[model samples]
Target: MSNLPTPAEIIAKANAELNQAYRALGDARDWLLSDWDVQPTAEQAATIRRMREAIGTAKDAINEGRP
Candidate 1:
């Protein structure tokens, strides 16, 4: 077994992982906002905002081929 991955294979894997992470963050943000008042801490809102910005930045990188 080898530890190294081909460039194409690495790119494919990274893209898939990034897409999944972005989707999960979006889902979490949606869930938080839908029931924001139930939370007793500001952490959830802060986290959702940060995740939204991160997703936007990730999408931009993917689109710009800078990732």
Candidate 2:
């Protein structure tokens, strides 16, 4: 058993991690909207906004070289 990852394995792991992060952003957005009436703290609002922006940037990078 070696500790090194093959190129394919590394790519797969990176893709999976990006997918999970995207999904988490979606979940956070949904929760924020659904619970807006509860008046989330300013810190919570800022955190959600940051998460959404980070996800957008990641998506942009992924799409950059595509046609």
Candidate 3:
């Protein structure tokens, strides 16, 4: 009990983690595009954009009720 986080604290931590993961994914994608010379086709670009958007949306959904 002493070591347990409150519900709000747990939600805050989870949201922070999710945001970090999303940023990491975006950074990886940027590195591939800029440093690794990625050349995605139109469809591939769309797919990547959608995936990024989905990651953000999921994070928002998860953090909806927390402070």
Candidate maximizing TM-score: 2
lDDT of 1 by residue, 1-67 (tens): 9889999899888878877776776676566557444664588668777877876676666666535
Q: Which stretches of candidate 3 lie over 4 Å from their true place?
A: 35-67
Candidate 1 error regions (>4 Å):
1-3, 35-67
Per-residue lDDT, model 2, residue 39, is 72
lDDT of 2: 0.71
lDDT measured at residue 65 in model 2 versus the true structure, 0 to 100: 30
Which window of 10 residues has the lowest lDDT sum in candidate 3?
28-37
Per-residue lDDT tens digits of candidate 3, residues 1-67? 4988998898889878867776776676565456436678899789877877776676566557435
Task: Select the stronger candidate by lDDT from 1 and 3.
Answer: 1
Winner by TM-score between candidate 3 and candidate 2: 2
Q: Residue 7 deviation, candidate 3, in Å? A: 0.7
Clashing pairs in 1: none
Which is superior by lDDT, 2 or 3? 2
TM per candidate: 0.51, 0.54, 0.50
